[model samples]
Target: DFTLEELKSLRVKQRYSFRDQQYNGKFSIITFEEFISIALDAPRVVGIYPEIKNPVFINQRVKWSNGKKFEDIFVETLKKYGYEGSYLSKKWLKQPAFIQSFAPTSLTYISNQTDLPKIFLIDDTTIPTQDTNQSFWEITSDHYLDYIKEYVVGIGPWKDNLVTASNNYLQTPTDLVARAHAHNFQVHPYTFRNENQFLHFNFSEDPYNEYDYWIKKIGVDGLFTDFTGSLHRYQEWTSPFLSSEKDAYNLLDKIVAMIFKVQAHLVLFFT
Candidate 1:
């Protein structure tokens, strides 16, 4: 069991409060370094989706002797395991991953530290940003999207933002996707599940139909699921990228060169 200090310092947590209350009181959260090893060790590629869940809270409670921030440690851990280069790079695809966060400032903070793609998570309309203290409307605005698009590759909105609900009945869809795609930002909504309680009448108790509606009609770039195998199976069945390893590697090399140049230019400007 972790001490109060230790518990307050963790960036990761058990996602569910109901099924895993035992683990909650029992196990310590894994480090980003350990998480990376888990992904890399998978026989097939498995991407990680790490969230800067509570940046303001973490920084307030966790004090390091080095004066390094939690975001710094997170990116450092990733790089220590050779997690550099942009999204879909050879190094990435082999152990593909995305770093996600609700705090836009945290994403910007780590942008200079790592080139790996980041996703901005948008919570419900009522929730204000952790760092900025702005409403959901402020960040979802065109001007904000334009600014953030430079840092993150995509935005993972709450799935309900794309669709509405009334008395447990699913309502008509929203324009969240159209707006995101207009800014050329990828969209990956979250928490697709097979359970009947979460399923809508429109989906007919079939999770595949729900996937179909989201992937085919709504057009999301990726999806997050409790069951990775289902999403993997769906993608394999419907559409698969016939990517050549050599070409992907060469492109990655070029991007790394460009990234180096960008950093060098920044140093020169600062000096």
Candidate 2:
């Protein structure tokens, strides 16, 4: 399966319209399992954000034996390949990840089998949920949020849901963020990209500004980005984890600057 020919065509292109069209001819479609393997093979702890995308369509198209649902196979595959653990456990950090879906039933179904943390994704108000066909208004109700809070560690809602847009300008931020935070639920807005068209004018077309708004103003735990490497770099620059080498380097730099200042003062005094 590890053929040079296949790897050569392994570039990734935009999966949507209004994105950079330059790389459309270069990239190949990748699977969730392959993505997991890539993360697992990384030198340090690499996190993965895998959504159970379009389960209704995938289940309708794909088949299995012994009456196994796609959910069954999917959870089994992850567990089989060593992805079993609760949220933020030692085992989970070894393969840091979150399983997300719009269908609440799917989350409940997998709950019986695995303790891995799950996130229920919310779309716009008019769209019906995938499994139960509940409208977004109903699913997003306070009662429902309180109910699902037990099953899910977080909610991944559309970014617009966080802040409404009125005539292409941002309105007052919604209480949804505050309510969700009250219940100790993490809010991770979806599908942030790095294009002028994707960003609103409020952020000055800088992705970091958008990140600052979401992380500081709105207060989300994580973000779902199209460019994982860019998010990694942004997080490292702004809110870097205190690794030993980083700490040592920072300390050394501070000491060296202090020594230079001290030497300058001594030379002035002696002269």
lDDT by residue (1-271, candidate 2, tens digit) is: 3555676677776767776788776767566677778988889877776777788887887778998888998888788778878898999877777899998988878888888889999998778997788987788778999999878888999988889887656778888878888878888888798887778888888888888888888888888888778787777777655466689899999999999999999999999
Model 2 TM: 0.82
What's the residue-level lDDT of 142 in candidate 2? 89
Candidate 2, residue 223: how far the Cα is off, in Å: 0.9
Please give, for residues 101-168, the per-residue lDDT of candidate 1 as tens digits. Answer: 99999999999888899999998989999899989889898889999999999999988878877876
TM-score of each: 0.78, 0.82
Off by over 4 Å in 2: 1-23, 240-247, 250-271
- The C-alpha lDDT values of all candidates are 0.83, 0.83
